[model samples]
Each structure stands twice: as structure tokens, then as C-alpha cells.
Target: MLVIGLTGDVGGGKSSVALLWEKEGAHIVDADKIVRELWREPEIIEAAVTRWGSVILDSDGSVRPQVIARLAFSDVREYRWLCDLIHPKVMRRMERAVFASNRWVVAEIPLLFEVGVPWWVDFVVYVTAPPDERLARLSSARGWGEEELRGREAYLLPREEKIRSSHWVIENDGTPEELRAKAAELAEMFSFFSEPIEVTVSCGSEEEARRLSKAVIDRRKAACVHVYPIESLYWWKGNVEEDHEWEVSFKTVLPLYPDLVGIISKEHSYEVPVINMASVVKANRDALLWLWEELSGEPDNHAHRS
Candidate 1:
């Protein structure tokens, strides 16, 4: 399973990117949504009323988030107090979501670095756009005045700092279609495993191994393939057997697994060829980006995948 932390500045389209990943079978754990549910808890509303003296309540006796935000962000001490009261519980929920399944998961935590989310996240994806573009989007879509936008922006870390800490960057300065393309790439980048899969196939001779490996790379199904000599020992027809064989390993994405297997099965010289896969688990970001470029027929940026 891969756990990716998705975050960005205000109006940078973090939700849009998250939606794309969700469409690709990634479970989205939205931190803002979790906090919204917490607001409706009776105990939480009661606590807010008790501490803030009913100023943060509504006519129907519910907590008013707008009122609370105005109060909390106005004073450093008040903000810390509010965070202390709710962050621990919210973090617990976030942790549960990360470990809930053995599939790709994307957690949209707007304050990922500020709140110090778990370090176990496989990688961080920071969405970005020009300041002017973000400001325009906030004004038109969110109806936020310049002053309001500045107020929110002042609370977050600088864009350069966020980019420095991120493992991947997604630029959201273009049209929705362009952003969707980036989102789809991101979804594929983190699906199933953060690093590429190492698929190994045993063959009767080096000729067969080399041929299969060349075919995979030529078809753009893998970034690279290696063939090596090896000895195999396994039970067959109720008898243990030992034989010299060649192993070919291909580095590729999970979505291409079925295709790689099919090709190897068709090209093998044995009745039942041995094929298996192993996860890379972790690797250099540049290396992964290089692999993606090779597989996608993109020009080599080498430094970044975006």
C-alpha cells in the first residue's frame, strides 16, 4: 500500500487532484471533511461552548465554525488552545484511514506540514500555481476578498518552502483539462506502490531471457530489463528437481503487470515458466521519474516528474 499526502496553498486545486486519484481507485481521506464531522459531535459542541462562553454557538445550539475561526486566528494563544483541543482526535482518525486498506490511499491534509502529520506517509505531493492565479481563483470561486485571501495565506508556509519539502510537484496554473492530465499522471505514479515493480521470469536459456526482456522494453511496458544466470530448485510432478536457468527481471508499473505477464507467458520456452514480482518499496525520486519518462515516451526532465 502507498500512503500519499496531498497538500497545497489556498485555491491551488488540491481537491481537484484528490478527485482524480479517487477516480483511479485511490481512497481519499480528506482532513477537512473529518473536521466537519467532528463539529457535529455533541461533546465537541459542548466543549466549544464551555470554553468560548457561547459566542461560538448558533441559534439552534450548534457550534459555528466561522465564529470559532474568527476567534481562533485572531490570537496566537487561542489558536493553539483550539488546536490542542481537536488536533489529537483528528490525527487519530487520519492514522486509521491510512492503515485501513492494502491499496493506494491519498490523504488531503491542507495543514500537512503545519500539523506534523505522521512521517510514515510514503511521499508528499505539493500542488502549486502562481500567486496571481491563485488569488484570482479565490476571488471568483470562493468570493474571498484580497484581505481575506491574504489573511489565510499569511498562516501557511511559503510556497518555495513547501516545494522544497515535497517529493512531487503538480502545477495547477492551466485549464481544468491540463490539471486533469497532471492528476491522472499523479494517480498512476502512486498507485499500488511508490516505486516500480520488479517482475522476474525464469527461462530455459539466456537467449529466451534476452528476447523476452528486449520485447518488454521495446513495447514500452517497462523502463528496463535485466537477464542473469541462476540455478532453480523446485518440486514438479511430485519430485524435487534442480536445473540451471536464466532469470529476467523487468522494472515497470503495477498497471502494466498483466501485460508483462502475458508477454512472458507467450514467449517462454517451457510448459510452466516461473514468473514472480517484488515491490521496490522505496527509491530515489529522480530514478522513479526517469522510469516514468521512459515508459511514457516523455522527454527526460530528469529532475522532476511534473
Candidate 2:
């Protein structure tokens, strides 16, 4: 699965982008929501009460997050203490959510740069908008004035630094539809890596393996193919079969698996070739980009099979 660390400036529409990804079938792991749920735990509430007294609790004995936020944000030492207390627990839950998800996972962490991106995150996407736009959004949505917005933002890393550190940066000063379209496009690109597969086929000889590899690449059925010699042992014709064979591995996406299989079946010297496919759960981003680019074009139907 692909795990994206989604973060942005205050009121930059990071949640909007996450929601758009959710609509595209990506699972969302929201850090703020996790924090809210953690507040409901007796242990967490007890800890908060122990630190700040019962003043941090509501009349009903529930933790008041806004009260804690005001206290923590007012003093640097208090903020660090609060983060130290809550971040570990929040990270644990985030890890569990990401591990349990089979689909693409988008983790909306407002303070991702501040707390450090998790090692499990495949990439980071930073969202941003104009200062005026952001202020307008916060004011209208949360009734936060400029002074309050600036106070919260002062604790975060500089916008330029965050943008420089990110793998992708999204500018979100447009209409909601436009932001949704951008999210959709990004989701599609991420799906390419999440659904890529490595297909292995055993050929009768080195020459056949080479030929099949060329055929697959020439037709754009696979981004690339590697051929190497291997010893095979398997049951065939109700008897143990042993042979020296060549293995061909094709790097391609799941959507093109059938086309790759078709090329192998039509070109392999063996009547019943050994064909196996495995999902590529992780890969280098640059390599995946190259592979995706190679396979992005239409198939070369004019090329003859040889």
C-alpha cells in the first residue's frame, strides 16, 4: 500500500484534499480526529487532569481540548510537554490504522513537519494557499481572527521550508472543484505504484527468454523485463520434472497484467510455461516514475511478434 503524509498550513484546505482522496477510495487516517478520540480515554483524561487540575475538564468530567490547547499554546514548555504526552499514543494509533488498510492511506497530520514524518510514510504532500486566502478561510470557517491564526502558525515550520522538504506541493487557493480534481489526479498516480506487480515466467531457454522480453517491451505490455538462468523443479505430467531454465520477470502495473500474460503465452517455447505474479508493495519513487512513464503510452499494435 502507498502511505501519504498529508500536511499543510492552517486553513489551507488539507482536510478538503483528504476528503477528495477518500472519495477516490483512499483510506484517511486523521491525526486530529485520533487526538479527539484519545481525549475520551480515561487514562488520557486522568493524565491531563493530573497536570492541569480538574479545570481542564468539563462539568461532565470529560476533557476539554480547547482549554488544553489554550494552556499548551501559551507556553513553549507546556506545548512540548503536551506533545510529549500525546504524540506517542497518537502515532501508535496512526500506525495501526495504516497497517490495517489495504487501500491507499492518506494521513492528515497538521503538524507532520513539527513532529517529524513517520518512517512508514512513502511520501509527503504539502498543501498551501495565499496568506489572505488562508486567513479568510479560517475566519469564515472557525471564527479565528488574524491574531489567533498567526499565534498558531508561529509554532510551525516556515511555509517555504515545509514546501522544500515535501515530495509534492499543492497550491489550494482555487475553487473546491479544482482542488478535488487535483486530488483525483494525485490519487490516480499513487494507484500506479500501489497496484504494480512483478510477473515471472520460466522459459525453455535463454534465447526464448530474451525473445519474449523484447516482445513484451516492444509491444509496451511491460515497462521492463529481466532475463536470467535458474534451475527449476516441479511436477509435470504426473512426474517430478527438473530442468535448467531461464526466468523472465516483467515490471508492470496490475491493469496491464493480462496483456503481459498474453505476450508470454504467445511467445514462450514451453507448452505450459510457469507464470507467477506478485504485488509490488513498495518501490523507489524515481524508479516507479520511470516505469510509469515507459508504460504510459498506447500499445504498439503495429509491431509484429517475432
Candidate 3:
């Protein structure tokens, strides 16, 4: 599986790139969603309330993010304490997310490096812009002053470190159209070198599975397909039993996922089927590049994205 981690400074246009990836049919796991979900962990929220006092709470009794950000994002000790509380949990979720993203998964994590999670990624794209540009963008978007911007900037790892650590860099000081074009270009380039995929599929004694799996792989619905015998343990009709089954796995470029799903549903034997895709965990670089070429859908297929 190719795991690409995307990160950028505030107002650096990371979302634009993620959106572009989505346009070409890539799955995106966003860290912002993770953090929002984390706020619902009562113990963690209670601990924060106790540490920072209750003004951080809203009328709905949820911890207000702005209030929490004010406390934890500015004061180093407070920020470190919050990080100590949240970073580990976030990382754990990130691990699950990466694994869940079968094939090429693009994760939009804003503070990916600041939280020090780069090692988990196969490729990292650090989005950046000049501080002045960042401040200008943020001020226009959030009505923040220079001091506020500096405070936000200071808490993050320096820009230089972020850029130095990345395999690719996206500078966001240009217009949205420029950003979109650049992002499209980079995504195409990355896809050009991605490995051709392989997949494993599992199915209940449904007669259509073998044919379906083979057809999907044969037609490039997914890059590769594997069928295996599976012994499943579960409860049916309030009784548990072990049942023999066939599992088919598919390795395919991300773009073909929708079609893959359609085929599995249309052909699988089970009335209610299991058709979940898993991200590729690790793969040979040569295979990856080949996959990339097909995924990019370059005009000539022989031509490189660049």
C-alpha cells in the first residue's frame, strides 16, 4: 500500500491538493476529522477542563476548540501537556487509518510532522508559504492580527524543517487556479511511478465470486486479484460455528475502486456481502511506479506525467 501523508502550514492550501487527489478518485483520511472526533472522548475532555479551567466549555458542555486552542497552542507547557494527552491517541488512530486505506491512501494531516508522524508515511508532501503570506491569508480568512498569527506559527515546527523532511513540497503563495494546476501535476507525477496493484478477495459460497474476481483483475477493475479459502468464525441464528469460505482480494489502482465495488456486489454469493477494500501495506517500488502510470491515465500511457 502506498501511504502518502499531506501536511501544510495554516493557509498553505493543503486542502486544495487533497481535493485534487479526490478528483482523480483517491481515498482521503483527514486528521481534522480525527481531532474533532477526539473531542468526544469524555475523559480526555474532562482532563482538559480540569487543567485549563471551565471557560473552555460551551453551553452544550463540549470543550470549545477555540478556547482550548488559545490555551494549548500558545503556552508551551500547556501546549505540551495537551500534546501529551492527544498526540498519542491521534497517532494510534492515524496508524489504523493508514492500514484501512488499502492501495494509495492520501492522509491530510495538518500537523503531521509537528506531531512527529512522518516515519509512518511512504511519501510526505509538505505544503508551505512565506509567513507573511500565511498571515495575510489567515487574517483575511479568520480576522486574526499579526500577533495571533505569530502565536500560531511559533507553536509549529519551523517551516524549514517541514520542507527538509518532505519528499515533495507545494508552495501555496499563488492563486487558487495555480494551486489546483500544480496539485494536479504533482498527483499525476506520483501516479506515474506507482506500482501495479495486487488484491485478495473473500466471498461466501456464492458462485459468481471466482468469475467476478477474475474479471475485475482481468479488466483492470483492480490491478491484481487473489482468491483464498477462509475459515470464518461467527454467530449465526444465536449459535457460533466455523464455516469454510472463499476470500478474494484485489490489488488495484485507487481510481477503479467504485467499479470494483459494483462488480463485487453484483457477483458475490452472499445475500449480504462483505466488500471492503484494504490499502496496500507495502510494495516494491518498481511495481508501485507501474501502478502509478496506469492510475494517472496519461494520454499515451507510455508518457510520464512530468
* TM-score per candidate, chains pooled: 0.76, 0.92, 0.66
**Higher lDDT: candidate 1 or 2?**
2
What's the best-to-worst order under lDDT? 2, 1, 3
Distance (Å) between predicted and true CA of 95, model 3? 2.0
Error of 1 at 251 (Å): 3.3
lDDT of 2 by residue, 1-306 (tens): 778899988999899999888888889999999999999999888888888999998899988777898999998888998999899999999999998888878999999989988888888898888999999988998888899998888878898888888888788878888887777777777766666789999888888889999999998878888889999899988999899988999988887888888888888878788789998776776676666567866232311111
Taking the tens digit of each residue's C-alpha lDDT, what string does model 1 give over 215-283?
888888888888899988999999999999898989887778898889888888889887898876555
Clashes of 3: 34
In candidate 1, where is summed lDDT lowest over 10 consecutive residues? 297-306
Q: In candidate 2, residue 27 scores what lDDT?
A: 93
Query: Which portions of model 3 show Cα errors greater than 4 Å?
Result: 192-195, 198-280, 284-306
Cα-based lDDT at residue 81, candidate 3: 93
Quick one: best TM-score, which candidate?
2
